[model samples]
Target chain A: MNAPATATAQRKTQAMHKNLQAGICFWSFLMPALAGLVLFMAIPMVWGFLLSLSHAQNTIHPGHFIGARNYTDLLTDPEFLNSLWTILVFTLFIVPATFAFSLWLALAVHSIPKGKAFFRTVFFIPTAVSYAAASLIARMSFFSGTASGFANHLVGLFGMQPVQWIGTASPPWYWLVLVSVRLWLQVGFYMIIFLAALQEIPRSLYEAAALDGATGGWTVLRFITLPQLRNASVSILLLNLIAAFQAFDEFYNILGGSGSSGGNIGLARPPLVYIYNVALSSQDFGRGAAGGFIITALIVLFTLVQGRLLGFGSKEGR
Target chain B: MATPMLTTPVTRRQMLKTFVFAGGALLSGCARSDYIDGKLVLTQWYHQYGEKGTFQAVHRYAREYTRVNPHIIVKVVWIPGDYGTKLATALLTPDGPDVFESTLTQAMVEAGQTAPLNDLFTSQDLADFNPRDIALNSVNGKIYGVKMIDDLGLLYYRKSMLQSAGMQPPATLDELMTLAAKLTTPQRKGLFLGNDGGITAMLNVLPWSAGADFLVNSQIVFNTPRTVLAYQKLQQLNQGGSLLMGAASDWWDPSAFTSGQAAMQWCGMWAYPAIARAVGSDLGAVIWPPLDAQGVPVTFLGGWTAMVNANRPHVEEAKKFLQWQWIQNRAIQTDWCVGYGFHVPPRLSLARTTPKLQQPVPAYAVNMLGKYGKATPPLWNAAMGSDLTNAVTNIVKLGQPAAQQVAAAADMCNRELQRELE
Candidate 1:
């Protein structure tokens, strides 16, 4: 072989050897997580899809495959329909409320000249609280239906009669409990995310806007601040939307009867809760899997529609 | 960067990859059952009872059993939080409990998770148990579970409240309604049948109280005109602004009654000791009053049962332990029922002779169990129960027409029954 060719061959072999070594290292690092994902998530998900087509109930064994039957049955199932409606209603209110509230808090916190870190930590503290504990606190102290409840006691100061916040079906004051506890538990995390995104916005943009006769805070926020936050807001909105749809812990813990008997969850039985009851309580794994896939499809569809409507990935303005 | 570095063929990456796979395999393998001292180990699962001493008692029983049968070591798994769901999920796995305590239903039998215990029971032992319990636990005449206790559920009312309101214990739903309104004061509400507004526990009892059955020979019959009328009456209670709603705990806990939040509560006999300690003789219980003239008052009988997992490797040993614990060990059974929580011994002989049960209140409960106690129908599974709850919620809480809601729920339940039949 010629000298240049020999050197080229040697370098090519070296590159190949280097690439192979890098590949091995990458695989070594990735394999553990990949295997876990396949075992715990991917495999079960595929099994669940199979289960959705079956008449299988309690047992993991897919006894019989009655294709499309569980899905069709779910379409007519009143409990499933009610749960879907409940989650849809919940998501509609919660997503917007959380987005606006978190954005407002982020803006307010970001604008603070001093003790910003302290306030940020204070606001973010609730994110660390488990949904179960927060729901319990809401039920036991704040929105308790008794006359001695915190909310009731506050209302009594204005000569208002004690309200049955949770138990009353007429007004559905339990919504306040469910919505407020969720907001308290999740708002902080979303707020921090918004705050981080806000900090990344160039200071020059705000200065230029201020110099260009945009003196009012509202005007600056309306034109620049919100538009700049599009990406972060979309992310937060999508996350909140998905999270709201999957709401179970707060509703289940607060409204669901004490953990003695498997709680009497009424009025606010979301789709996840309904699926859990079907899968776990009734041991109807087929129906549960079918409902789960329906919910997954719903979420994906909503996210896609939202992305398209908002031009989420487009860089038209940015 | 050099040719020698590449050509030397470093194997660290490969070794690391191998290590990761090996570690995962090792960790996963540890989950399999282990033998100690070459003894066959059997794991039994039990739901965490709210009653004190239940954990210790269960562990002690397991230890005692192990001591007697040295060849087999019994491991007691105290499962808390969603025990039913957990047990059901666990039963799907090979490593699931050998024996577990839960309400024995035809679903368990149909699912083939539970082994029939008829072979373990003597005819005399079968005769000793409450026939209603055996029938409820049986599917197609093959008994699947051994009854551990018979929990009596009825209405607990405060004597002072009743006396102040000038009311004898109510005999019918109408009278109870009137008494509720009259007994309700600024400090206390008239009744609390759980925060679900009597939809959770009392809904099933109401239909029976109204002289209606949930299912009669594979036919849904809970939506009769009488049941509709009875539910409508219950709707009045929900709308009447007299119920103590949204207590800290549910109806299962005696706190609502003990704290005087409710003058009367629908609760089980398990709360007797706690109520006595808190209220001191102020508590009195009665069977849920009838709905109309044709109806008779009813009390609910609910309790756990022991069954060997049909899938367990040690099914025969599990069944032997069940027979030993629940059948032969009458003292253990009595202690389990009455020692910690006030449960009526399923054995009529033990119930008759047990000292704690012969007390005034307990004796009254025992009498009610004999006279009015009804085991839930075998057809009334969890799914059907949830459907009935929805019907009650519709009829009572939402003020939906009783006939329509009950009919809809009953239709759904009948469909479920048909599915189960299939």
Candidate 2:
């Protein structure tokens, strides 16, 4: 009985010693990342939140506490309101389009038996291009309003006159330029994601579906492939929606001119651009911070609603 | 298995140690650069200039200064793209440059970002400097910046193109319209004010040329009948299809004129050398032609001034460097203004003495600038400038009537000015 009791005591002590070692290892692994997260992300977020509450006019530092005034002013500001609306319109148009285009491209690449890797690489190459570089190419070469621009040259081939792509205001050609560049730059990334999800889909499912008369292309895609990609689709949709709403670079480089004074907040001014102008250009940091929070809240609300409709993050099936 | 597990831990520990050492070395490296004993390091910033040899010239000047003063190091930071916004943001931080060059705006002055240079300049210095340039950089009768160079913004036309079109350089708004129409061809447009439908460069000068000023007696007077007429004329120019809608660059650049994209271009005098190189002796400049024979042709004076940051840790050292570089050293000043780009020296004595100023094309521009040059008012801040620009956009691009846009802009600008004053 004494031997058994001593052995049990020794086992308990060893277990506690093991637990202590595990804890140290866990913290050691997490320390570097956790320190960076706190220093860079957490602190700035808190500082920015405080700035949103104050009357910080010219500087980033918080001034007199003027709670809710910046937020309230945004409700009536025409430029800010227009910017919000512009982003909404842009997201509405871009998200679904990107979804359809990327999915279609993914489907095409997956079905191709020959040179599948080659085609995949070709489609994904644009994801490596920087947004600023892409926007400049769009501005200076492709969608330039001049007769020599690639878009104009393309239109000329169709027997249509050279269109003023960036300069024209009536028909809103800037939207076309903005949307096309974003799609060209981003579609490849989403397509690769969809392709990975497609590859993960079991071959047996298609065989089973084929037995059930799902032989046609549309039938296979509709009855088998899409339902299987629900998780990836949701993620891509959310990311695309958020990115579309936060658009700045292409619009800024193409439509809004560059200067220390900032560019014109004309047509296609997204919420981020408006906030940037308010904070950096006008030096009204309080209002800018408030606008930033409002936009974040909007994005959150949109994601929540989208999730609810799509039943994402719900544990119903398993 | 025991040996492998033991080796993994040892390797991980070695990796962690390496990271820690590397981080400490980096931190020490960053700290050591600015903390040298008994030496004051002054960081001076200049906006990116398009003129050739500008970067090298500024570096040479800084090097010359450090050679003379061993105890102080003048580190010149050349900022590219969006200098005003970047500088404003930097000035808020403790690590901002000690000295910089920029236009003195009302917002900058009110924010207490600029250090007053009253003690630096005496009565004789004030008298010798161009009074207008000095006045532009002063707030409440205290000078804030020393002028480095005076830039002239006006119309630069191809002389051969104008002559071929049977047009002498336009002397009035009416003549400019006729000349523009006559110069239009299948390949090239008549005039390119800017890519943004001429609102960027021509907006301020148009109203000013019509005897409408941004502020008269500290009250907004930009919405006068004359200004409305000027806007209407601009609208007509846009509607007439003679204005170049898009170019490779903006009105501030000479690219459109040099590339033969437009017969005439609105640009700054800094591009004169480039324009002269591209178009040869065919380049001729004129101020924004007057609204009528009764009015005067106008050239907007767009220049940069060197100022010491009030929030800097080494304001005195920075000021001393600025004085030594641009004020006392006449040779460096001449090189800065004339070596890289064609700019009028802000000092009356220097402008008169520079041999380059005696050249025909530069002489013409200098003479015109002296005669019809205008400085933006102290009351006309960036916000006000943006408001006026928006008004111009509505009138010219969106086809909104001038009177309503002008009135709305005037009201907004006046409210901002009042708020700023309070």
lDDT of 1 by residue, A1-318 (tens): 599999999999999988987897698689889999999999999999999999986776675999899999889988788888888888999999999899899999999999999999999999999999988889888877677889988998898877888866788788888899998988899999999999988999999998889988889999988888888888888888888878889878887865422324667688888888778888889988999999999999998998888787888574
| Candidate 1 off by > 4 Å | A1-30, A259-264, A316-318, B1-30
The digit string of per-residue lDDT tens for model 2 on A44-66 reads 88888899988775677786787
Q: What is the lDDT of residue B162 in candidate 2?
A: 78
TM-score of 1: 0.94
* C-alpha RMSD over true interface residues, model 1: 2.2
Clashing pairs in 2: none
List of chain B TM-scores, one per candidate: 0.93, 0.91
Writing each residue's lDDT as its tens digit, candidate 1 over B246-315 gives: 7888888888888888888889998888887787777778889988899988988888888899987778
Best by DockQ: 1
* DockQ (Cα-based) for each candidate: 0.54, 0.42
- Residue-level error in angstroms, candidate 2, position B63: 1.5
